[model samples]
Target chain A: MALNIVVCVKNTPSSLSVELDPSGQPKTAGVLYAINPFDEYAVEEAVRIKEKNAGSTVTALALGPDADQTVLREAVSRGCDAGVLVTGTEVTGGDTLATSRVLAAAIRKLAAAQPVHLVLFGKSTNDSGAGSVGGQVAAWLDWPGVLSVKKIESIDEQAALLWRMMEDGIDKVKVGLPAAVCTVKEINEPRIPSLKGKMAAKKAVFTKWTASDLGLKPEDAGAPGSGARVARYTAPAKRGTGLRIAGGSAAQNAAQLVDTLIERKLI
Target chain B: MNPQGILVVALNQRGQASPATWELLGAGRALADAAKQPLFAVLPGGTAEQARELVERGADRVLWTAHPSLKEFNDEMHTQAVCAAAQQLSPARILLPGSVAGRSLACRLAVKLQAGLATDVSEFSPSGMVKRGAFGGNLTAEVEFKSPIQVMTVQAMAFPPAARQAGRAGEAAELAFAPAAARTEVISFSAEEAGEIDLGGAERIVSGGRGVGGPDGFKAVRDLAHALGAAVGASRAAVDSGWIPYRHQVGLTGRTVRPKLYVACGISGQIQHLAGMSNAANIVAINTDPECPMMQQATISVAADIFEFIPLVVAEIKKRKGVPVAA
Candidate 1:
């Protein structure tokens, strides 16, 4: 039986641009854009799932402005069968709740066309690291979802066994069929796209849809639909002024370090 | 009306709840009492018995959905059930222990609910700001969510486990649910069962890194830990290089610990390594690098070769504790 899988992909600024301007809030501009690295793991997992099941198709679904296609194209190159761009001004500045609702509506439409068997997302977005969208999407679509999956335990038509990375060790959990899963970087190495795949993506058309297209109200697609707000973004605290030890043998350095730790009551 | 309840999602395998679930419930009780909210536990299985044990601990209610298909953790199905319960109950806050499954589930739920989420939170003030490790655990970050429903995953060992208090009995609420068919299925799962207890719950940990040299080097570290009655730990580098089993690795790629004492032997502190144990009550370092970052973070830093220092330190500790030291 042919199965359809959708991987939610997003492009985010590679790293936060931090600056101090009197106030603690960092200057947020001048950030570079790249495919959310963890999402690449999701795309790779989706492609691998399709490969194993045989007769399965993988679609990369993204919600962003025009520039976001950079990640979608990257996914296509990695072996996604097609891409969907749910884009519009309506979704601008939407928080995770709104974002999930919009994506869930889009998935609903896609499901109508091909019957989506599985949904995948990265564990968290770099910008916010909120890591909520996948779970919210499962709720929006009323499906079972799992997050931070480090290893795919098993996959069959009936269910999927997975190992989730925790603060301590891995937790073995099994999910029944038609589940949604979020991937973390520890899961797998994302494949680099071939030249042929790149060319194919360039020619492939992204199915662009707006909130109206998904029968969602405008308010339900943007900030008003969001569950949380970002009051401000700030830089992380500075490290302790680094201490340089004078020239010494390894033993000497170790002794000095120990002395310092003892003074600090660290050891 | 305490409309805002404390919600916890319990993870089970086949039908038994993992030990972490109890730890979470213990934490949940504290948060619930603080917030003046009821505590509800959600567990997935074919029967409510999977979560019955929580009632004896402090859970006011156990919302369960028993389905043959829901026996395993299908994220989609689990999320659906938990979200349904959350929506129905409208909890003001959700507490998930910062375990692998907890972090994953919490992140997904935050996105699903469009709520604010903080991961690996070591300290959370009543105010929204949370203290989390940043820059490889060399520093801390204060994260505040602007959302009404705050979702947090507490780091393991960050808070002491709460003793059981007299609370209402746990009531199991069966749900109308089913697990989504997963694209992948578990073919098999094989884990290396460590002969020793899990390090996450250890009171003291003695960790070695690449600087320890080779397999033989670890024997000394192990002997020291045994002498100290502490668990053994390893850095990611040691595990990746096959110097030690992954179960022994301690760092961002490994386990996070907040033991009473942590001793690093022959390991130069990497940002990732510190992230795992930065919260320990006291840290001791034994490395040749006087300028090594770990030395700066460690309260007790020793500048010596492990081969040379191990015998002396072990002998001293043994002498003080009135134990025999290996010659």
Candidate 2:
């Protein structure tokens, strides 16, 4: 059977430069948002699978603010056959549970047109880094879900043999079709968008959906639908200015460091 | 189902609780106390020894199922087993250690229970809400659960292991679960090479970064690690440059390590990297730049060339340990 796949993407402020306002919320001013780094690997893996399986289609699905359209265009330029952006405050302001639920609903709506063989997500988002949505989406869809997938060793229409990153090492697992998987960084090296691909992306018009379009009520979609709320935001524990050991010969400084470590019983 | 009390769950490692599970127990005990609820522990694939250990580790009640199918992990069947446990107990809150399995299972379980959830939680605010890294670990969000049931997977090394009350006997009941056949089958598991330390639980880690010019630059870092019997870690820059495997990468996206001591060599200590090792008991930064973030946050900062400093540290530690120096 020809497989139909959906890869989810998120665009977030660069991890390297997030500054919080006094209210403990991310200062959105002047922050550059890019396709989450991990999702680049997801899109790459999806496109590769699409290439390997003839007649397969890869749809890039993103649930975020309209600004996330750029990531979808980026995905299309990379290799995705189509792009759909699900926007509105319902998902953008929600927690992982509500967010996963909305995405699962979108998948169901997508399935109404064509059977979705697989759903893909970056292992986690850069902003939250919870790594929960992928597995939760599987739960909502009642499909086999694999988390932290490192490799797809082999895949047929019926099932895919994949490797999951585990505590001690890796587990080789075989998951049936119609499953959801969260891809890790080790999956594949993403390709740069070709000039032609970029031009196509520029001309591509994306399909947009709202929570209401996905059949979710206002209360069941956004912060109102979320089970968890951020009661407050706090700064990370302040680490004291570290002590410096310098102005000595290499051996002497090394010896002093060793002595200090020994004194602290750190080694 | 009426939900009350705190439920602690951890994936078994060869029929025993993983080391981080005890830490979960500690956090659970504290949370349960603050919430004024009973503490419960569920071990779906646990043996009697692990059940006893959990009891000694302060689980007010232990639920275990030694289901054979669960002996080997089949995510579907194992998740079913935990769901069965939760269904039976209907605890108000569930806590798990942030192992790969725990995080995965926790999410699926949350969906099954229709629970509010959080992942990688590091602390609890004064009001009993969870505190977790957000905006790439630069800000902390104190999450409050609105759902009747809450599920969370906590970061490793964030809390101390529960103190074992030796010789204490507690009640453990077999959790009867008729598991559904899993759609996901396990073919095999390849263990990380023996003698190569896992950074997650390592007490000491020697990490390299951008200044480790190439793959060869890691040699000095490795030498220091070997002398100290420590795991080797790397910053994202080094890992991205293909100088080291991703397994050794430590940062927000990589493994979060809370070692007793962390030695950073040639690392610039980006905020992302600091997110992983900032909690270490002691941080020793060896870098050429005096004003770098890693140096500033380090417990001991040495502004020196890693190439020179690493060799000297290795020799000194080896001498202190009474080992012969290499020719």
- Best-fitting candidate, scored by DockQ: 2
What DockQ class does candidate 2 belong to? Answer: medium
lDDT of 2 by residue, B1-327 (tens): 579888899678755568888999999988888888888999978877788889999888888888888886666787898888788788988998787788878888888888889998988765658888876677788899899999999888888899999877668888888887888887888888888988987889999999989999999999989888899999999999999988898987788888988999999988889877888888999999999888888889999998888899989998899989986
Task: List DockQ for all candidates.
Answer: 0.21, 0.80
Task: Compute the lDDT of residue B55 as modeled in candidate 2.
Answer: 90
Give the DockQ of candidate 1.
0.21
User: Positional deviation of A98 in candidate 1, in angstroms?
Assistant: 3.0
**For model 1, how does the per-residue alpha-carbon lDDT over A28-66 read when each residue is reduced to its tens digit?**
467567777668889999888888887999999999998
Runs in model 2 lying further than 4 Å from the true structure: none
- How well does chain B match by TM-score in each candidate? 0.82, 0.95
